[model samples]
Target chain A: MGLDQPLEGALAPPMRNGELAFEEPWQGRVFGMAKALCDAGCFEWAEFQAQLVETIREWERTPEGEYASAPAEQETYYNHFLAALERLLEAKQLVAGGAVEARSEAFAARPHGHDH
Target chain B: MSELKPQAIRAEALESLLIEQNHLTAEAVDEVIIRYNERVGPMNGARVVAKAWADPDYKACLLEDGTKAIEEFEFEGGEIDKLVVVENTATVHNVVVCTLCSCYPWGLLGLPPRWYKDPAYRSRIVREPRAVLAEFGVVLDDDVEVKVWDSSAEVRYMVLPMRPDAAAAMDERAVLELITRDAMIGVAR
Candidate 1:
């Protein structure tokens, strides 16, 4: 996902014919959550984008097995990404308050994990 | 105590005689599909959304917290290890992704459709959501900022797209039609 590529109205979709697509709606959810998070000041939009781009570039460059079995490295990158996601979701909920109980309860009903 | 002591037989002898057992529990992917087939489909979400559009209190409650709001219909993202719901209000919308090998909440949504787990999307969307959405035929206004989520672990997200005015009064099926997969993710109109 090159930030430089523009895909708005006048341009062609950036993806190639055989390139993978996203599940609609949910795909859009990615941007929506991020935007909401940024707007709420959870993090600066520019900074967030910069981090993701850097991470993506680094991963793309390294071979998958290069960091294999090294728990520290895997956790370092993956955990930071998850943390960012959590912040975004929290901000979105904060902005849209109401009927929060049902949502909270629904989430609670799901298996709450304890990391090994 | 006898001089000719009897040696103990190894437990391996007993274990080797037993037959191997198989499990009924489905793999993560299968379980994901089963849940999608059983619940968490558009109809279910539509019911909740319908309630929100019609009832301010419920909508407020849903906006405040989605997991509990969804339970009103006895719908639970079974086996979905994590659930994160994002609603699109007049001013904001939401989207989701699994940046590290697709750690999604299958419990809320059955198996992630292939594209979500695809390299192209997971690789591109986070960096270029605007361009990706355009590729998918969605054009966002420049002022309406787009946010991209990168998932790792069990956490997963769902976008509650703002109900389009044109979809008003439409049946659940009708309304869902307008809720394109991309739109639900918050990259489109």
Candidate 2:
């Protein structure tokens, strides 16, 4: 029932005082969602872990470094987490295809300042 | 094709979908955010620092075993591997960074500020601690030694910032209010 077992050793993210370190609020949100989903048995923990590993690997292979040099370029560890989560949810049929994209478009259409 | 968006947008989208599908509830998402924002954060670290400043015995325990000492406050997280507390003194100052990545003591300090995770900080802090501290407006004395702790997955560090003279008269809660996150990170004194 503990939240720490699946993310031990090589798979563990940088931590301080036993909590996961996140630079942005969304990073923690995404992280919490993934953990919550796993706890609810929507998918296996290993499944998400595999996807995350693939995402990180793909990022490492990109022409640029794993992170974008500029803020506008949009590369980050949590971005990959979102991408991987999307893939997992879609593949699991937990979410209908295009649901995430459609929701994202709706959010973008709003007038609020969107700084991620 | 869906455009790759920022993490916040994507997370929002994901949450909506999950809720719509009954995989998650809207309340769950709000609960997580509230937990991080309110229940856990720098205030926890500030309280710890305040207690250390007030009680020499607790400070001794904190310096000896940070992980165990922190548990006394009932702040426990599963992801933290090790907690090392570096004391800042008149002769030596300590700052922490994660060169390889943005490793931080989130259980005590909450989420890291944006600048702490910047590549410039990751690269520059190690090379020129004094100069970087200067940019943050922390000008150290010429005789003081600057020590930088690079946090890794195996171990994480928090700086025990030197107590200010004025703080001696303040109560624990007041002292806690004065301890900012930057000071605990050693970016500010």
Candidate 3:
């Protein structure tokens, strides 16, 4: 069927002055990484999407405060999105398993105000 | 400066690791982000909304076949393939959401805002739309019907808000200013 049919559901996105809003730089960066990787054919877009939805669903099923101090809802979702990407990369052998965790821990140890 | 949050660090780590492996370049990742920031965004959707507000034939075509009609503008991205344009009349209002994951009309609306992807919105909007709309400062009259469009990866939706009475004498260019990404998503009037 054509797209003329109205698919009704309640909807609204956080906005600032009628524009798409981003709270942090990494939110966009991680999103870009996923898009860029998929575009480069590292993995199919649908594969990432399926993983993302699964991650969110798993988060939803988890009990409250189970996610390591419970970040804001927005951050929480992106965290799951990030995890999905990591999982996809590891599964595809694009990046070694646990390498992201090791790398992140190393980056976290840098002196204050020093992020490369 | 405060320490970078773990998630941010993880994101950066992923970027750096991918770059190190040659699977991706920093420039390519930046290009995707830059494209969203500068080029592909709601303005594209606003142009479509304005065109529909101005040309009757185009409006009919848009309503009949949104995917084919919007191609006239040559927007980038495959998300528009199943584009569905829903109209808001005096008696009805429309909104868009993706409950499973955040599937938005990226070519038209840009990346969805944080709330759109939050569980609070994804779970609540379908059950209590009026309450949710009220929070967004959109209070419909008791008689006006509200229709929520649940977007899927295959078919995306955008709302065509009614031309405000004030813009009657104005041209399409002027009307374009009246359309916001929020309104096209059925959040604002």
Question: What are the root-mean-square deviations of the candidates from the true structure over C-alphas?
Answer: 19.7, 8.8, 8.7
- Alpha carbon lDDT at A81, candidate 2: 75
Q: In model 3, which residue pairs have backbone atoms overlapping below 3 Å?
A: A7-B149, A8-B148, A8-B149, A9-B148, A9-B149
Alpha-carbon local distance difference test for all models: 0.47, 0.74, 0.79
lDDT, residue B26, candidate 2: 51
- Give each candidate's fraction of reference contacts reproduced: 0.00, 0.40, 0.63
TM-scores across all candidates? 0.50, 0.71, 0.87
Instruction: Evaluate model 2 with DockQ and give the value.
Output: 0.23
Give me the chain B TM-score of candidate 3: 0.92
The prediction achieving the highest DockQ against the true structure is 3
Per-candidate count of clashing residue pairs (backbone under 3 Å): 46, 3, 5
> Best candidate per lDDT, number?
3
| Per-residue accuracy of model 2 over B26-133 as CA lDDT, tens digit each | 556546555565677888889989989988999999999898888878884334567889899999999999876567787888877666766678778999999999
Which CAPRI level is candidate 3?
Answer: acceptable
Docking quality category of candidate 1 according to DockQ thresholds: incorrect
Better of 1 and 3 by lDDT: 3
Model 3 chain A lowest lDDT segment of ten? A2-11
Looking only at chain B, model 1 earns a TM-score of: 0.70
Error of 3 at B120 (Å): 2.0
Per-residue lDDT over B13-71 for candidate 1, one digit per residue giving the tens place of the 0 to 100 score: 11111111111111222333333444544455556566676677987777677666666
Ranking by lDDT: 3, 2, 1
